[model samples]
Every structure is written in structure tokens, then in C-alpha cells.
Target: METAFIESPLGITKIVGDEKGISEISVLSEGTVSKKIPPQLKECVSQLKEYFNGQRNQFDFKLNPQGTDFQQKVWQELLNIPFGKTISYLDLSKKIGDVKAIRAVASANGRNPLWIVVPCHRVIGTDGSLTGYAGGLWRKKWLLEHESPSQQQSLF
Candidate 1:
């Protein structure tokens, strides 16, 4: 696996993957390179930059996230979450065809290794409040604000 670090508005990010696909992308306070950046990773980094800049909405890079089959199913559902939209964990649980598994769904979401690309940040509390985010609640708030339909004028 190859890894590279890039600075994002949310924080420093560490991207890890290989020829098959990207395995992980997580936020970090600082970078520690255990592997060199590969050609495929360069493309992923470029696409990530475009995403953060709001120049791109969909990610086209390959991915090979590691997790249980159930977790993979939940993550796939997360991908269906459109950009600039939010879904409650309970809603996601239903969409996955198991309303009783809301906690399991949330747990899978927490384990999402791809971060923004997988869009785990789009999930919120059932009461429309921001909730658990692996990166941080502040970053989650900032991401939602960034993707909100209302522009900065609302705050102004």
C-alpha cells in the first residue's frame, strides 16, 4: 500500500491505497509517511483537491475499503447520499432494509475509512443535529455549511 498526506480545509489528510484501489483516507494533525505515493495515489490526490475546492461533486477514483459485508453495504448506501444533502442514521438504517439496525448502521458509518469521498459527514443525528464524526464535530459542521444550499449570505 502507498500513502500520501495532503492539507485540506478540514485538516491534514492521510490517503492510503494501492493498485487495486484506495484503502483508506483519514484526517490527521500531522503527516507520517510509511509508504511512498504511487501514480494512482497522485490521481486520487488531484481529484480530492478538486472536491475540496467545490470544482467536483462526484469522485471517480477506484476504492477498495476494508470492512465487513454489512459495513460495505452501509458504506455503499452512504455513497448514494447525494452531495449537499443530509440523512439521519435512522433513515440510513431503513434504507439499508433494517430499521432495527440503526446502531449497527451508525457503527459502520463510524468505521468508514474513506472520509469525505465516502461522505460519512453527510449523516447527522435523527433530530437534525450534527453528531459523531471521526474527524471532529467542528469539521463536520464546516463541511455541512460548505455544502449547504444557502450561501454565506445567510450568516451575513
Candidate 2:
């Protein structure tokens, strides 16, 4: 697997993947070393840039997130979350057909290795508050703000 760090509005991001597909994309607030960009990572980085620029809503790159079957299922459901929409962990649990698994659902969301591409940031607390995010609450807040149309500035 190849790896590289790319600076983003939220923070420095660690991207890892190979020819088959992307395995992980992690947001890092610090402790990142710059490395050579791999040719195979070009597409992933391009799509991520588009996403951050608000030019792309959905990603088209292949992915191979490492996780348990349940975690994969949870992450797949996360992809269904719309670009500017949010869903509660309870809602996600119901979508997965396991209402009692809300905590499990939230856990899987926290474990999502693909980050923005998987849309784990779209999951919020039942009370509509920002909650657990491996990328830190501040970055999560920035991402939510970025996706909100009301928070967007008019360039015109």
C-alpha cells in the first residue's frame, strides 16, 4: 500500500491505498510527515480536492476499507447520507435493521477508515449535536459547516 499526506482545510490528511482501491483516509491535526505522492493516489487526491472545493458531491474511486462485516455495512449506509443532510446514529441503526445496535452503529462510524469518502461525518448525536469523530470535533464542525449551504459564501 502507498501512503502520502495532503494538506486540507480541516487539517493534514493521511491517504493510503493501492491499485485495487483506497484502504484508508485519515485526518490528522499534527504529527504528519510529508512523503512522495504515488501515481496510484492521483485520482483519490483529485477527487478529495473536488469534494473540499464543493465541486463534487459523490466520489467515484474504488475503495477497500478494512473492517468487520458489520462495520462495512454501516459505512455503506453512511454513503447514502445526502451531501447536505445529516442522520442520527439511531436513524442509522434503524436503517441497518437493528434498532438495538445504535451504539454498535456509532462505534462502526467512529471506526470508519475511509473518512469523508465514507461520509461518517454525516452522523450526529440523537440530539443533533456533534459527537465522536476521530478527526477531532473542530474538524468535524468545519466539515459540517462546509457541507451546509447556509454556511457557504456566495462568490458572486
Candidate 3:
């Protein structure tokens, strides 16, 4: 697998993949950005830049995240969530056909390897509270606010 790092508002983002498809996209608190992007990962890099710039809402690139069947099912369901929307973990479990699997769903969500692309940050606690995020809660908040279509702009 080829790897490349790019700077993002939240931090340095790492992308890994090849012609088979992108297998991983993760964020780091600190890292060096790639001076040259791999040919195979150019589309992903471009799409992500558009996403961060608020020019794109959905990702259409191929994803090859590694996970169990259950986790894969959960991640697929995560894609159904609208771009500017949030869903509770309980709701996610129910959508996956197992309300009792809330914890499992949460665990899988936390393990999602494709950060913003997979949109794990869109999942929240049942109380509508921002909950667990592997990238840190603050980054989650920033992402949510960034994606909020009705968000306010600075008066300046």
C-alpha cells in the first residue's frame, strides 16, 4: 500500500491505498505533509480538499476499509446519513437491524479507519451529545460545525 500525508485544518491527514481502492484515511495531531502525492491517491486528495473547503458533500471514491462483517455493515449504514446531519448511536444500531447492538455499533464506529470520508464524526450519543471520536472531541465539533449548512458566518 502507498501512503501520503496532507495538511488539513484539524491536523495532518494520512491516506493509504492503491489501485484496488483506498483502505485507510486517518488524522494525526502532528506529521509531515507529503511533498509529492502518489498517482493512485490523487483523486482522494482532491476530493478531501474540496470537502474541507466546503465544496463537496459526498464522497464517491472506492473504499476498502478493513473490518468484520458487522463493522462493515455499520460503516455502510453510516454512509446513508445525510451530509449535514447527525445520528444517535441507538439510531445507528436500529438502522443496522439490532437495537441491542448499540454498544457494538459504537465500538465499530470508533474503529472506523476512514475518518472524515467515512464520517464517523456524524455519530453521537443518544442524548444528541457529541461523544466518542478517535480524532478527539474537539475535532469532531469542528467537523460538525463545518458541515452545518445553516451555520453562521462571522460578521467581519
Model 2 residue runs over 4 Å out of place are 31-35, 152-156
Instruction: Give the local distance difference test score of model 2.
Output: 0.90
Pick the lDDT winner.
3
Clashes of 3: 0
Residues 1-156 of candidate 1: C-alpha lDDT, one tens digit per residue: 888888888778889899999999999877654345578798889898887887777798899999999999999999999988999999999999999999999999999999888999999999999998888899999888877767424575
**Candidate 1 least-lDDT 10 residues:** 29-38
**Model 1 segments beyond 4 Å from truth?**
32-36, 152-156
- Please give the CA lDDT of all the candidate structures: 0.89, 0.90, 0.93
Where model 3 places Cα greater than 4 Å from the true spot, the runs are: 152-156
Sequence-dependent TM-score of model 3: 0.96
In angstroms, the error of model 3 at 91 is 0.4
Candidate 2, residues 69-93, lDDT tens digits: the string is: 9999999999999988999999999
